[model samples]
Target chain A: MSRTLSNPPSVELLSAVSTFLINDIAPQVNGQSAFHIKVACNILNIVAREIENGADLNESVCEALSNILSDQKTGSDEAQDLQSLKAELSEVIKNDQIKNNAELLDALKMLTLKQLAIDNPKYSGYHQALKSNER
Target chain B: MNAPTDTLIDNSLSGYLERLQTCCRKHFGSQVEVQNLSKLSGGASAETRRFILSDPNKRSSSAVILRTSSIQQGAEFSTSISKDCEAQIQKLCRSKGVPVPEIYFCLEEDDQLGEGYAMSCVEGETIPPKILRKDQYATARENMTDQCAQILANIHKIKPNDTTISLEDQSPLIQLEKLEQLYRQYNQLSPIFELAFKFLYKNAPKKHEITLVHGDFRNGNLVVNEQGIKSVLDWELCHWGDPIEDLGWLCVNAWCFGSELPVGGFGSMDALLERYSYYSGQQVDLEQVKYWQLFGTLRWGIICLFQLNCFLTGLNRSLELAAIGRRVSEVEIDLINLMEAL
Candidate 1:
């Protein structure tokens, strides 16, 4: 604290920085900062980018996913049953995986992703990144 | 000084410029040239500015991109980045034919510049905000599904140690253990989500096979051009984990195109699955993809809480940051609804 007060950012310091760059540093840069602070700002932007707009992205997706899920699940009691199924699958996964049913969990995951995509149809990459019908 | 819990953070131009000058001098030699610390059109991880660096010999060099970590990247800096991992994996992935810029340097030590890296900047369109303008882009956007899958296959094909590369990441037991630890780290949550979390937590896959996971794969993270994908950017969250994590993340709701179609907002899920199946020679499992998709939204919701907490800790304050901190509600709703409908 004492050191900071003793050497505050005075007019001279600012001028010296500006002048030194204009004369000595500017010539070398032709005037540019290589690892620029814009880089730092960019870091902030990355954070800000997600912050400012991520929810809209989420809502748009959820609404979209809902539409798809309705289409694929295809029944009046489907949504209600999915909740029960999710729980049962969770139990089956936690309790035990018969070596014979090793492929079952994978099948569940495929179903979950498909269900998710149905709600958020824009998430087409689910299929793009998978095997065609293993689920 | 403002209250610590403020969400908005604004940068000082002078401070930015000084840091720029010093960073340049230290890295590029005495002739430090930093320009445009001013904001660029599109950025999500940190504030970015378009700028150039020149040599002492008067021969001009390619422009460089500087990236720093921001609170917006995620509330938990640790969550959004492992700079060491990012630097190493990027270099490795690029060598393995994954398209990305050639990183010049990653500064772990911040003598002058903050934490960031210098890379040869490649010009391409990644801004979802702008990419929608072209009719060609809209019509051909579906192609991104196959294109992205092919690139992911190239990445997946790179056998890090041979063993972990073949399997999808969800070894149910480990996933359950990790999620328990992770959820515990985020103190506040609704009871509904707690139940949902418990259900998913209990259900994680038991297979221990590992693979490369680009934890946040999505359309916004991809850079593209007329022909196809130019570069796949933002590698900080990548790790050795279930391959499904990346697959699920890629297909999440947020990156949809203008149309309501699924893959990158361009096509049907079935078509995307077919393309991936064609390339990988593996049977397509809709069920596994669905499981990952659910987990992806769940994970995203938890991550939003971490970001919101950053504001509480005074790491950064910006309206954008505040807004992001607020967005957790939507993801929470997504998680709850999905679990309910599951």
Candidate 2:
């Protein structure tokens, strides 16, 4: 069975990729040739989404990061703090160097804590929302 | 591929040898006989077919191994096999007496062989599981120190030649970039790997003497017997590059085969370095080797991921092959911790 979900690339590549996760991937999947086709198509779709909206996500992430850092400095944007921190994370991970050096290790550590997140059983939803415009 | 022919009559040695006999007579000349084609049952990377053979009018045959990518757990191919380049390296190593397999004849141009060649397979026990066993490896287990150091030193000592020199242009850094490019080409799923790549990039090593590196040199890849280290196998991953890559790979935990022994669970860091330095006329840098180990772990983890994808996604569904892919998470953890320790 294939999942067919699409999110606008610039606004929600993660969302688009995740929305169809059930459609694309099914764990406990046994020996089947179609399993190969599912993974190949899933990866292809993710890449297409990234290509379509990678720049927008990158730019918005950077802008959100700038706002978070600016608010932190002035003590004026506490409300946007957590949300922007998450956005800044998305941006930092977007930065290849930062991801490689500081963030990825941190993320893995965080992931160990959040393994099989109960809140989002789908598991790919955090990065999904980070990339999408609306729920 | 044709379901592997179910071995042969009585599941005996001659079944494989008979097939070899046919190959030799057809390819080499009359009197080409294949004998002692034994199955080297346990290999993490490839299903190794071990054997012996003789040339026409010769009383005895030389020892050799036929390496073919077998259907195994976590084994799948995304890139073209370099059996041809490996044969080329074996040809050179045999000339230099580097303790590597001696290549006699190869079917580099033939498609039926499915990426393999026949080499002067030195007599040895390549069983990693039994290396620590008291009974099976009593003799080879003892000289693990001297044999490992001596053979490793010999591999490092090989002189540069046309085939090796041509590969030097693709330096260690370039190779890393190429690996990253190849992985990314499949698609970027987890950003977790980006962290490892960034760490590698930031900690890139300065250029050094480009020697012929036995790309996958490690304890598991070495052939040992009652006498000691007979030869090193799997030059398929061979290339011209920093020799430290081999040294670093030797230290990887998975290759160590559950032994806490340094470099095949036989020697020490000092022993490995002392031997290498004594032969090369240069001081060995333990620190640089540390960096390469981190690189090694990351590269290995990614390769494992490729294996997992192959099976998990159904490109190849051999459960044994797919299991290797699942273990990538553990390697990823090891790598993260290792870098964190640094």
Candidate 3:
């Protein structure tokens, strides 16, 4: 109960503050300050969402990375952080090793799209990709 | 906390307008009064001030725009050219009948106001959403793609010798290398960006034809009116390079503003290419354009990351810069879509 109590409460607080800023405070300001405050509210909303779903997203990214890099020696590093996994994947890409590998390509595309899904779900390509899957 | 060093400079609007009045007195024999000075938004480094100048004796007033970089202490990424060179480029483009603001004068360093220049302000809607959707700009929106192509063709037609200012040519491959180095300098690994870099390297095009590239020819950068594109603004990124670079950069998905249209949220790529080839008398190469589009997507993605770096490294540190960090993913998704299509 204690573990579950901490995270959602903070996310809820951020959501309330972000909404208040957007709906209430934003209309009272004008010009550059108004635009900036709107951006600030958007940032808070993104942070709130990230707080709610960050752990699951990270685990999904790790699983995707592990599946893609299964052939490499560093693939077995189960304890590798997200940064290390990214570094390993980038090094592999830089060396021209992943060419013509359909599985790795799909893995990379899915992983990047997952990031975009979190960062900007409204992105055109993300919606297009979703539509294609449905078709 | 210490304030930014450049902000300490005299930024008082009245004081700067007085200096502009002194400059105007030299241009026009009679004393002129500056009226209605308002700072336009965007341009973190370059300051765009719109004002009107009137002589007491003469009943008429001219709308003039003054751009100043007095506060930009040092060059950050993207803003690589000087104001003097920008003036020269605009002057040359004006001579060639390219839709550009007429250059008045470049503010000298000795005049006490740090480097900047002034030009006759052309009236038009520069906002993307208005240009894309509003009834006032509907006609301009319809003709934007064709005019954009034709204007770019005319811009690329300018020879290096046409302008007195010596311009550096940044080829597509060289530009990619510089961008990759900047990415590495950030010291953070992005597998998505690395994939894009690798793809670009593998598909790098040979220089099609060396010409003046309107480096930042995109939606927000163009001034459009009811007729069509009134003028092109922001010559800071102008350089000599492959002409298709401009065409490719224009069609980049980032310029689309959530619209399905590939060419600046107004028209189709086929229409752009058709118009461009007709205007420039050069054949369109679809594959090369695609490569540059991919390259442009990656380049824009890196720029976002670079701005985030500017925020994280405490170099600029604004909410706008921090907000731009989120846009890197849009480019990433766009790049992946391009890759899958290829």
Write the residue-wise lDDT of candidate 2 on B1-342 in tens digits.
Answer: 101112222243334545667777776677867665556543344556666667758676677667765545654433323666667777777666667776766654433544567766575566565565647577776676666556556666764654442334446688788777766644433444555666678777876776777777776666777666778877756666777888888776666544556565666767777777776676778877777787787777677767666666676776445445434544555565566657
lDDT tens digits, residue span B51-157, model 3: 78887788779999887774656436775578888888888888888989998888876666668888999987777866888888878888888898889889989
Range of the 10 consecutive residues with the lowest summed lDDT in candidate 2 chain B: B1-10
Better of 2 and 3 by TM-score: 3
All candidates: TM-score: 0.58, 0.64, 0.93
Sorted on TM-score, best first, the list reads 3, 2, 1
Every candidate's TM-score, chain A alone = 0.30, 0.35, 0.82
* Model 3 spans with C-alpha error above 4 angstroms: A1-8, A72-78, B1-14, B41-44
Error of 3 at B336 (Å): 0.3
lDDT for B121 in candidate 3 is 92
List each model's interface RMSD.
12.8, 10.9, 5.1
Candidate 2 lDDT, A26-128, residue by residue in tens: 4534334344434444444444544554445445544544553453343344444333554444445446324234444544544422321211222222333
Mind giving the per-residue lDDT tens digits that candidate 1 earns over B1-342?
001111122254447666666777776787757654444432345544445676656666557776665434433433445454566677777887888888877765664555677777777667563454576566347467787777676666655584322333335456556665665565553333454565666666555336566766787777777665778887876656656556667765556644455455655778767877787666657666666777777666665666666666667664444545544544544454345345
Which residues of candidate 1, in runs, are more than 4 Å off?
A1-135, B1-50, B55-61, B68-81, B107-115, B132-136, B162-188, B257-259, B309-317, B321-329, B336-342
Candidate 3 C-alpha lDDT tens digits along A1-135: 112566558877887888888889988967566768877887886776676677778898987787677664344657677888888888888987774555666677787677776677777878866665576
